[model samples]
Target: MFKSKEVEIPLRRSELISPTGIGALTTNSDGINLMPGALDMWFDNADIMENEFEIYEERLSKIFNVESFRLPPDYRAPFNKYQQAEKNLNIRIPMVRFPNWYYCSSCKTMSKEVSSRKDSILTCSHCKNNYARLIQVPLIVACEKGHLDDFPWNEWVHESLGPRCKGPLKLISTGGATLSSMKVKCTSCSGERSLRGLTTKDSEHLYDHLSKEGYYKCTGRKPWFGDRIQNEECSCIPQPILKNASNAYFSEVLNAIYLPPNRDAKIQKILDLLALPNIMENIELLKKTAPIPLIGTVLKTNFTSLSDIDNALLEDGIAKIINSEDKTENNENAVLLNLKIEEYDLLASNEKIESDFLVVQPEYDKDGNTLLHQKYGISKINLIPKLRETRVLYGFSRLNPPLPLSTNRKEIIENGKSKLFIKPQKFKWLPAYKVQGEGIYIEFDDNLLSEWESSIRNSSRVSKLNERLNNARQEGIGIKADVSPRYVMLHTLAHLFIQEIVLSCGYSSSSLKERIYVGPKENENMNGFLIYTSSGDSEGTMGGLVRLGEISSIESILEKAISKANWCSSDPVCNEIGMDFGQGRDFLNGAACHNCAYVSEISCEELNKYLDRGFVNIYDATDDFKSFFNYVETR
Candidate 1:
């Protein structure tokens, strides 16, 4: 039995009785369970398993198979702090966050939305069956591996993966804080920000990724990349290259690294640029606590007022004999006092008070230098706007601009095929899902679960699985990702760089640029990587002989390219990468890094052993993806 963890899932009060599966699974980690002699167990019904479960096994196995990647010089090069100092640069993978559309229990089918207090209301939408059996009850009984879809690796297939009953995906947080000290922000490209900056609206991502949370649910079942936002048209910053490099005006101290010195002013400006909550209220409170007196001397009463007071006093006695009438008009230009003092008017009457104050741009960088850039260097000004525009398209704030859903977007946001964010609180998108419900789920029966446990423990498949895992893990963000090892990556990087260089000529004959995907054929000690291209009616099938056998020389050329890039790293932001994490050696050791994006000490001998997995080995492909680029720096 999968020790089902009672997750705090949000369901409509009426959603508990639905009969359909609400998504149940067995334990997530096979390695922890069935350690010694756990394989003798057999499934009571292997026939049913073959029908629904076995179809995906072969497909999943291919993802784990090993292959080497060929990277280009820049892509294969490891970036270090000193190198990055050459250019002000930072890198983080951007992902799109989108509203999850799914079938519901209340509706008895797939649904985009249902009117309810909570999300994922499992009640029958077709009949509002208050007594419908929820999908959670028997969800785990369907499969021995305890999964609903594909990706049945060890931990996912085993029954005792962790300390909880298997719960529905998305809702369950994989407990245990593992990534210590890892700082990440909203990947959403923030647009034109006002003075104040931003925090990722989707705390869920930052929170969820931090310390797996509670129980393992699914994340990123889709390694789906967003549609390439055609950079051909986009005008990002021009990366300075090697035409005639110049440092005409600026002078440097020595080999010492430079950082944007903290001018409390700049930090203040940036902070000022961000929305600091409770500011106005704090100001109002300060005003209330301040001292401002309306004294008699300051009031400056007129002599006519004293005379009128005397006359009124004398008239009091004579008023009985003679009927006396006195009139007084309220002065429009005068300051007045009233017993209910708070109501008395003071200075002006206008909606907003106009202030006559001078605005100043505090001159200077954090360092107290004679001057930094001569003038506000707007040479790169064009770059700012283009980058901002792209962020707008991706749904991030520019710099730190606010993106309140305006009146024009109300209708579209509420009732559109796509929404910019998920519900309750909207977050950044810019990234979206290309595939849906792309994850693994599982169930368990005693006999079936027993075999599943044994298969994981005593089977020789573990070693093979590890090899496949190692291949996929080369550049892994999470579990289920096919990684590349360090050595194999160098080969891939070198190949990628060269392919790109060859492609810029625009293809005359049969030779065209082909996107490569490394996979396994029916039988071969060496894994196979397939190639596809873009000039398609043939589905991009035409390309030259795009396969790697035992090619190691590819790494050497790549390393040289990386070194050149790093040497100019001070100018281009990218060159400074690879070495920042102190893993520079590992990333730079070889001509190419493995699929893991490791470049350290890569030799031909290493790339010959491991292999690649098609295009998601994007890490290796990145090796020379920069080959198409040329940087001509101007002094």
Candidate 2:
């Protein structure tokens, strides 16, 4: 029987519960929490995992260069007593106390153990109060080396451990009620100290007793585990932080765009055969012995019988699907090239309508007046009425930004293991969320982009972006240096288009998201980005976005989008910002700000970094050296 029934909220795999949310849900709220369990548990708990989970795993792992991605169980509505199941995928995060010290509001008595019952009623033993109101201590100390512990209240009040007198501690709050006004006192030894000036603005001098020389060191407390007493080895100085502060814990999630394995009808047919359940093991045996009539009869059960093809032909198709392979390229370029080729072929097909594979149509004609294509160096424009995007949560890091490829994987991944099972030896899979939506794809002309990359200012822009990437790598932030003039230009274009489209289209700017394709000149170079809306709602697949891509409507969109990019509300100040040293997180950008180019944090692929309006169209009409689309004459 379950201990308690907590209200479960349904959220997409993409919309993950932040680390702080996970902690608060289990500790602060009266919700039923489950532990991480076996892979089979997800199948039992979630229907989506049981049916389509493996396909996503195979596709996503290749894209992200991961071993395997575990699918999170779909959260279901609360069950009735009779419908209760044996397994629940709802995870119970490790019980790490927020304020390590819990204070009784009535008696002002401070104790580490404030909650007396499983029902979470705070009872004070000092005042003989059965139900005492407890306030969580907001003060916490965390080191850069990923260690957390309670503030040194005992040592701070006494200033030293000289007398070895065990004393009862009480936190006294005065009229002022500021941090300095609140003082800690030892009721037995009569030792008292004010908590003023303990921390500076940077939190570097967290517990300096005298002149910043004498400071408290970290004890390296790891309370997330069951033992609750293990001290990890650390050398870094700990910084005092509030429990709810943004820096306390950061959730580092890695994401990938799902690309189909094959688009050819013949290849797809062969793949369909290989995908048959319990068929791979007996594939060879069936090829050698099974006759066409028997195969036809077997096919009748799951698919339409293929009578036209002979046994020899059928065997060759199956063999081809099994042996089909491509030369392995480096992880970084390979993913972009794959997406580029897929998008290129899809758009080049020039299909006006295809109802089966969601609404997607390319607006390209040999003689049609494609305004962006002819005038602005845009190669292709394709509208997607519906698409699906998957986001997965694998592991997280606390102080240091989690690097997916960094060799120091053990320290972070183990620490962020789903608070499901206690310390599993091997971690293979992670949870994923999927959302269906619509978008527009824009591909840039290759020759024009190549010319723009040669410009001095554009090269300078790329160098700064590379520097940011290198810094992120040195700090173990798990990012690759894949910046290019083509990338920056297209990214900026996507951002500007998003802003422009929101004004004309009914969709909100926040609802649209970007998927960029950029790679080296040696390979199949990609210079494009897709801006789409992916919502969990049923109305996400509306054809409004595709209509915007139509020839009649697109000419005006391009004209307006260019006009918007040419001049920002911030104007000279925005364009004049030097990008040589960089400005954002890693000094990765130039001439871009919130008033002109910034989109919602969720909508941007680069976290709103590596964007500059100056790269798209020249901020000043006279300067064309820095701009890719600057040479376009007014039509």
Candidate 3:
């Protein structure tokens, strides 16, 4: 028997695209494991869906080939009984029951039951006249192809005894430490099996043993879609995994910093309106007529209040200017790089841009010195008081980090490279959320960085790290950037800076994230990184982080960071091993470990890879010239 009740689970808006996105599981306060329902099940009313939840990002919209993005519909409660107008607007993100199998400790009976979104309680009918509470089974099965299903309990217990034999199942556990002590039995015929070897390497042995007997296989179940949807056909082998395993879901989120369209307020508004779907085409078609009055008419029809339409009409060739400015590169990587280059150009210019994307160089100290440390080549520091970052949940994977099947969006969705939506054919908008925060941007002297990189470009240590990176890429480990001495130096410095600044910035290291921008090649030469607060709270907007950009505080922090990098608790072992055999995931890190150079994975763009403290300061006499800040004496 099942009981229905409405339950509220509090979730932050940013969490919807991470840790608990679509297809990811979260346990509610009542201990009911729930998975957020598919995008198709989000909202019921069409008007509320379109007008209230749309988010606009021109670069992301063009890259993803979608009209717009949508924020997860937030639930609003009606204030009073007379507030009938607000009642219909209240919306909630739908959830579905997962791992539907439940066991009753009081009755010793195992049952499988599917419940609706509103049902939060289930009881065992065999015990105390249906008063015994049912506990959800924590075991489930998934395949690399992103299919999830309840564990095959019946087949494992019977194991060729008889599929026709219908019997009630009992899950029993003997007091022991290993999984072999837990067994499932058919109460009618006494057929039984233990749950041993189900968690071995890749669960290959268990899959082989059961699959050979024609019992355990993938059913291609997508339970996130509600109960009526049929399972798709799939032939991949399924492996038993715990419901809360870390590899259960890996979200593929894309983030972009907002770049203003124009400096003029009205011009920016007109460009934003033009970025909407089919508006540019309408303008082009209307251009054949009177051009000014006709364009003003179209703009007035599309926008709610365009009092500046006359000004837009008076401008010469506005449509042509907008079109030329709106063009983006066809290649996806090129688009992303061009977008970053634009940001780099703005941040590195040292000019104060005072719009939504606000950035200003910190004033020089009382001594009229802008340079914090000449020996370390610290060239410029800028403070961002206001910035908007948009993050979109595009797709997710089950057993691995989501990889693209092809560059083509349609092909990537169709081949199941990543599960974009329940029925991807209907996917027009992705779920996204935005954050308003502040940051500190630090840029290095290009000439100094080039000179240091050239001094050790062909050294043995540098060659070994590059070789490992190339190997990792060949094995499809997804190392996106090419490793260089300059990149490693910048990356390590960013980590040290984050670790040091958290002590005085009033924000924890977890709330501060690093965005490294290092391009050593001639065509795309850049040397800088941004440390920003991404929490979207009062702490993120406070001026504590930006105030540290002052010359006195920055110089003190840099000295401490370099001093801290000179020695690690792991010492010689951490610094020496990677040069010979390698360290960290896929041997991607050198001279770095959790105790020294690692930060929260959310803070690091490279997942804490490609780091080496030796790049920052001299740890040994033999590596003197290799250090970027070799002029600094050892402690």
TM-scores for the candidates: 0.19, 0.71, 0.83
Instruction: Tell me, by TM-score, which candidate is best.
Output: 3
Q: How accurate locally, in lDDT, is each candidate?
A: 0.21, 0.57, 0.74
TM-score comparison, 1 vs 3, better candidate: 3
Candidate 3 TM-score, C-alpha based = 0.83
Tens-digit per-residue lDDT, 1-635, candidate 2? 12333223343344443343222222334322211222323443342334344335454565444565544544544467654453443342123334447677788878875121233444566776655655666566777655667776776677763336556788888868557778888888898887665455643355545233365667765444323335656666677665555556545554444433334454467556656765554454554576433543454444544444444335434544333333244344444454444544444334443442343555456565455566777777777676666665544445444443334434445555533223444445555666677777777777777766765443555565566667766766556446666777788888888888888777788777887767642223667777777563665576677678877677777777667777778767666663545455445567677887888866776667777766777555443355666654532
Between candidates 1 and 2, the one scoring higher on lDDT is: 2
lDDT of 1 by residue, 1-635 (tens): 12333222222211111100012111112111000000011111222221221111111112112121111001112276566444213321122211222323343232232112122223434446565422321111011111111211122212223414232221111243222221112112211111011123333221232124333343322111222221122222111111111210011000000111222233334334222344324323433343212111121132222233222222222221111122123221111111001010101011111221111122223542221112111110000000000001112111111122222233323322121222313321111111000000001122322232243333232233354444433753112122323113323443344343334323331222211222211111112121212122222222231221112222233334333333221222222232222112223222213333222211111222233211112222232231111110111
Alpha-carbon deviation at 597 in model 1, angstroms:
9.9
Q: Candidates ranked by lDDT, best first?
A: 3, 2, 1
Q: Can you rank all candidates by TM-score, best first?
A: 3, 2, 1
Of the two candidates 1 and 3, the one with more favorable lDDT, higher being better, is 3
**For model 3, how does the per-residue alpha-carbon lDDT over 1-635 read when each residue is reduced to its tens digit?**
44657745677778898768988888888898888878887765654646567899987887677888988887777787776565335777877788888888677788888747455667686678555677787778899888899887877776652365566887777888556678888889898888876766754344566534564568889888778888889888787888998888877677777876554444556666665667667666666664555576666677665545555322323543433555554444445555565567566655577677888877786553534545467777888887778888877778766653224444443444235466766767888988878898888877777777777777777787788888887887766645678889899999999999999999988888888877632123778999888775643388889899887888889889998888889888888886767787678888888989999877886667888888887477364356888732221
What is the clash count for each candidate, in the order shown? 121, 7, 0
At residue 586, candidate 1 shows an lDDT of 21
